[model samples]
Target: MTRLALSALLATLALIGVATPASAHTDLLSSDPANGASVPQRPTRLTLTFTEPVPAESATVTLTGPDGAAWPTGEITADGATLTVPLAGSASPAGPYTVSWTVESLDGDFVDGTFAFTLTAPATQQPPVATTPAPPPAVTSADAAPTTTSPSAGSTATLDAPPTTGTSAPAATSGDGDDGGVPLWVWILVVAVLSVIGIAVGVGLNRRAKRGAEPAE
Candidate 1:
């Protein structure tokens, strides 16, 4: 009877060891966008890895921004021991953010926890520049019209006369005047008449002196 009692005690100890592990709750092992990390930009999704598998339908995640606004999340998905959920709507303001999660483990026990991270300022962007064009060039001397000059008062040619086609000798003119003087033939004819008159007078006087000498006889 003592040996039978000893066997029963050993069986009870073995059962207790098995029950202890099965009744244990799931624990979070690691996370993406890990706790206490500072990221340059907001993450698109949140992923949680646990020590044991959790049901996707029973998982619930809530994100709260620095402004105390409750951000929405998409449908939760499970892959082995990991749970992932997409973020919905626009990004939150830069500051600290809190992530709270609750899930049902394989042992049918509900577990919940909280973690926090920071969202730092992102990189800045700049704008573009403008441009302009140039102008054209100016007019040159080669593009001007042709010109003609008239003769002065000293010149013999008149303004109304048409231009001659061939070379020709210049006409004779009187000194210091536009109208001409007397001709050379007129002065020669006057000198010849004066000589004829003087000769005739000398012949007549000689005849009178000879006749007076003859009359005295």
Candidate 2:
């Protein structure tokens, strides 16, 4: 009976040891921006969520950015099952960012973890500069001189022309402008009307003369 009791006690002790480690250790459930996530903009803060609540003072977080520079952060805070670390300012020279964290759960178990995430390059803005298109290079007297030209003695080409005067005949009208000539179809219609009127007048005169010739008829 003594041996059996001793064996039972040992078995109980083994079970208790196994249960303590399992309950004491906390698991990292998730993180802000997520682990191994590619972020398109600079992240101002980091958040970590665990399977269980962790003590605020026992939590520690460190960050490394591109070029392995240490990123400054504000005081860490804990709320229930989450921990948040705020960056000092906007991150620069975007690239890979690594975060290391350690926390002590409420059960006094110390847990540590590391994760990597990437930051997309920030957009660079180019301010528009007011440029007055370099004032068309000033025209100098030398530049205004006409290029050399040679012509045969009898050439009729002349560059000079008499100045226009108000009395001068008006410039020839373009095809698009009105010219005073009547169209052929209009003139034909006018001639046909005149012919018809002349024929009617002649017929009336003939009738009057015939009646006069026929006497009392």
Q: Summarize candidate 2's per-residue lDDT along 1-217 as a digit string, tens digits.
A: 9999999999999999999876767889999879899988878899999999888798999998888988898999999989999988653667888999999976786999999898887645568998886667888854454443456654444344345577868787645224766667777899999999999999999999998899573
Question: How many steric overlaps does candidate 1 have?
Answer: 0
For this target, which candidate reaches the highest lDDT against the unseen true structure?
A: 1
Candidate with maximal TM-score: 2
Task: Evaluate all candidate structures by whole-model CA lDDT and list the values in order.
Answer: 0.84, 0.83
Residue pairs whose backbone atoms clash in candidate 1: none
Write the residue-wise lDDT of candidate 1 on 72-92 in tens digits.
999999998899989997646
For every candidate, C-alpha RMSD to the true structure in Å? 15.2, 19.9
Q: Give stretches of model 2 more than 4 Å off.
A: 2-23, 123-133, 140-143, 147-217
Give the Å shift of residue 15 in candidate 1. 1.4
Number of clashes recorded per candidate: 0, 0
User: Global lDDT for candidate 1?
Assistant: 0.84
